[model samples]
Target: PVPVLLNYIYSPSTSMFVSLLSVDLPKPTLTVEPESSVFSGESVTLKCEIKGYDGWTYQWYKQDKQSRWSAVSQSEYYTVNRDTLTIRADAVIHGDQYRCSGERHDRLTSSQYSDFVTLTINALPTATLTVEPEGPVFTGGSVTLKCEIQSHSNWRYQWYKGSSRTAVSQSETNTFTIRSAADQDQYWCRGERDDRPSSSQPSNTVTLTVKGEAKAVLSIKPDKHVFRGEAVTLRCDIQWGRDTECKYSWYKEANTLYSSSTTQEFRFSPAEESHSGNYTCSGEDIGNSGYSQSSDAVTLTVTEGPVFSGESVTLKCEIQSHSNWRYQWYKGSRRTAVSQSQTNTFTIRSAADQDQDQYWCRGERDYRPTSSQPSNTVTLTVKGKISNFPLPQMSTYLMFGTPKVLYLIENNAKT
Candidate 1:
């Protein structure tokens, strides 16, 4: 197609039109809105002004990496109305150049192309963080650590355990637990944002010391013999060289036994044969380490004499060996009523049939083990008038469900 000009005339005889064009106007001037600056999510307006232009149509073009200009306006990201065009800045506008060209009557002679105008969109700010624990856990445990920053925000957050960065979480919050005691290793967290010229200031650290599991060390006084019905105290101790906020517990065999944070002694009303077994103590440091090792075992023993039930008999508790010792007595095994004493002898007020069962004693020392042996078996014979009724050779008979009665003669003779 031939180029069209402003001075085209109609020739009726030849059925054609001639063109005449003139170039006398200055180039269009391009001015960016907002003084050539905008934030990443903001908009920018470009205005084109051309003098001496009539019936003008405007088109906008953007610059490419090779400095070449291409028409992109009149579509998305660009709007045209009269001589003004507006655009939304995307990530592509880091160093973009734009132009607005004007043309009138399609002559193309006096048309104007705008000067190169650069577009600058500021980057967005970003924030991110990392923590320890890596995962969930019990209240008290150790943790390792890790972290990274967000895109362009120039700010950072400092890690903290409780109030100090010296004990920050190691990784994501899931990575570690801060209860028992803070981690043994060094720790820190840094906050950084891209907007600021300098790095972010660290936050104050939160030092953490979680309470650990319960444990105790136990010691019994006087491992040797003790008198019946005497008082004895069991002491349970805990150790965490630097941490004193630990909890303590005492146990007998598999049972949970007792609990305390700082109670040193377990007082007993009285010592008896019922208290002859191994006892343990444990301590827990809630400040970071969970639990502690158990204390050494201790033994308690009580010696007493044998007593007879249902008959008048003498009861005594004695050491099988010649070791000097004390003794204690118990009607049954469960109840311990008397505190351990220095005397080796214990006497029942009255020997009855209930006291005829086997009984034994043990020895104890406050600082060491006390020695004691099982007492020799003693038989308590009923010495009342009618005590010989149940003999194998006796044909005893009762009337109307009444108990049978028998008479026994003195000098070990039965009647």
Candidate 2:
């Protein structure tokens, strides 16, 4: 006893560390996100939060209308990821109650079930997005995207890029515009509000192929003023593109004239007046760059007039630069067809009121569909045949009245 007392007295100024245990269970809080009431097809997130504690695994429960609770199973409609539960609202989930409880990892302790969070799902509306002036979407151009919902009023708009969770744009109006779109992307939208059924289902995604450019330079070979039978060529050049890897769309006024995939030039071996018009060009995507800008209009004019025939007297409707031409000869102001042949020619063999009329000729080829200018008119005048006749006889009642008697007297005198 004396030795024990001496040992206890020797233990001086010892500090002991002890941990206190808590018997009170942690209570979790359940919160419904994107509003408690939502439209069908909309996603509702239930977050279970337990404050002032760590290392807790959560279990979610849903109460049936019979007041019976059941563990939520993972499925297409319901998803559980850690402390969060996501429900895709549909017709069956109109009125549902949810609760959550936590289990600790460090010790064999659990949290009390959180208060119930009721969810009300309404019928979802159809949200659709449309693009104005639908066609090929150009880069650096304003793209107006409009969202329409099946029901509800005073709805606003929210725009998203691809499947991202964040909104790229939000507006009070139902229209979202991409001002000066610089690049291509997949865009989608939905209708939203500050009241119940906050957002509708996302609209179908629209894939926009935005090119970096919309400008081009269109040029014509030789000159904008072309002559018949002259070889003409039109070339569309994109500033940031290669000739081989790009395609071009050609327009005359508002009509599409041609589309070329291999070459940058639209060729006209022999230009015609029909080929003359205001032309524009756009270059399609080359590598990562988008279409080239539409080029400034280049006006093409074909000068048409008579091409002189080699022989003036021949009056031939001949086009020397072409082959397989069908020539037609016309006469008078009515353009009456006098003759038609491979080489149209007009020659006056006889003269008459109708025969001595103005004449002209023209050459046409059907192979490439071309018609030449008309030739100068020619006129003809005819005369009757000539015949030999005796000279004028002496007047019957004049000084030479007795021509026969005088002739006889002169004969007798000569004898």
Candidate 3:
């Protein structure tokens, strides 16, 4: 009797019962540390993470080339943590697909597999360090260190000192410039790419041997003693240093002949008496502040010897050391001891043809016979001579006739 009443009592709300069931969670995300593409032998970390969740056990899977998925185990090439995996050895092979999934520890709910991530291994490029001006460098000189990576252009460079890992300089370009290089400068370089942000192996270490400041030697082309109006060329040579390009400065005693010159050869078209002083030169490396030591003083002797005939000529004996000197003149290798002047000049007034001879002078001081080096010989040439013309024939016949006429006139006047 109750069954008929119960069958008619079913409500629509009874069919809407709340169902309690577990919802499928979102898949975990897998990412590689640094980048997916990395150089072989470089350490890399693979991380599996589930956002906004805790106490999740992560399982990592690597898919082979045959499209078969298998669980990864801890081995020499891999170190497996709870949610992270590390590749320890040289990762040479490529095309390994990886995925990760997470499971809740309490509810035993599993998440779907993450999107596949592929790893690409590349061989590290070889880095080489090269120096500019490969010879021995000098102090305070500019030097460039170039890092070369063959077949690679998009690379950043890092320079380091000897055996030191700390980077002394970093540049987007490959070259590292040093404005003022010092002694004991050693360097090495490494190259890195921005895409992977991993550094290649260190390049060969390059040791920079900085030499000391070089001493410059000044030399004169031809003899230092040059005739007047002759061209003279002075050269500044730095024989020992790497800095061959230098600015030259020429000095005549205390006066500066040229303030700055890029050429090592200082030329004088027509050397004059003013250029007869003690000349010296110093060299400075281009773009450097310090100058080399002054060269040895060179004595430039300029003499003017041959003179025109019948002209008043003076023979001067000059010395670079002291002005106080007595002059003794010589003619044709004969020293004229009788005539001595306290001054350095010996003058010949009204020079005759006999005076045309080789003349030289020597210096003496304090009436001492000891003389300095003999001056260069100078020949004097006398030019013109007097001319005598024969006197006109005397008019003897006309003179006799005039005398006889005068006598006859005197006799007639007396008669």
1 versus 3: better TM-score goes to:
3
* Model 3 lDDT per residue over 60-148, tens place: 88887789999986988888899998877475356778888988879858888999888887777778899886776666767788999
TM-score of each: 0.36, 0.34, 0.52
On residues 1-415, what C-alpha lDDT tens digit does candidate 2 reach at each position? 0112212223235654434443557689898887545666677889999988888889989897789999996888888899998887552376678999999878877888899988876665668988653544556555678888978777888888977889999988888877666667788898888766666878988776655565789999989987544788889887552322578989999688887555888888566545768999887654333456789999997643221111112344445455777777776887666777775444443333445445556667786547666654433322232234322211111011111100000000000
Q: What TM value does model 3 have?
A: 0.52
Decide which is better by lDDT, 2 or 3.
Answer: 3
Once fitted onto the true fold, the runs of candidate 3 whose alpha carbons sit more than 4 angstroms away are 1-36, 44-77, 82-84, 89-120, 148-156, 171-173, 192-194, 240-244, 287-291, 304-415
State each model's C-alpha RMSD to the native.
17.0, 23.3, 17.9
Look at candidate 3 and tell me the lDDT of residue 414: 8
Scored by CA lDDT, what does every candidate get? Answer: 0.52, 0.66, 0.69
Q: Cα deviation of 408 in candidate 1 (Å)?
A: 39
Residues 1-415, model 1: lDDT tens digits: 2334667799999999966865445578888777744656556788888875577777778878897888875667677778887885553366788887777776755455778788776654332334343333223454333334444343444455434535333333323333444344334455544443234334223233334433456777654455345677788775443534556777777467788546667767567545656777776544444566677777676544322233233333433334444555443353463434455444444455554454334444343335433333223233334454533221111111111111111112233
Cand. 2 TM to true fold: 0.34
Candidate 1 regions with alpha-carbon error over 4 angstroms: 1-24, 33-45, 50-55, 86-91, 106-111, 132-415
> Ranking by lDDT, best first?
3, 2, 1
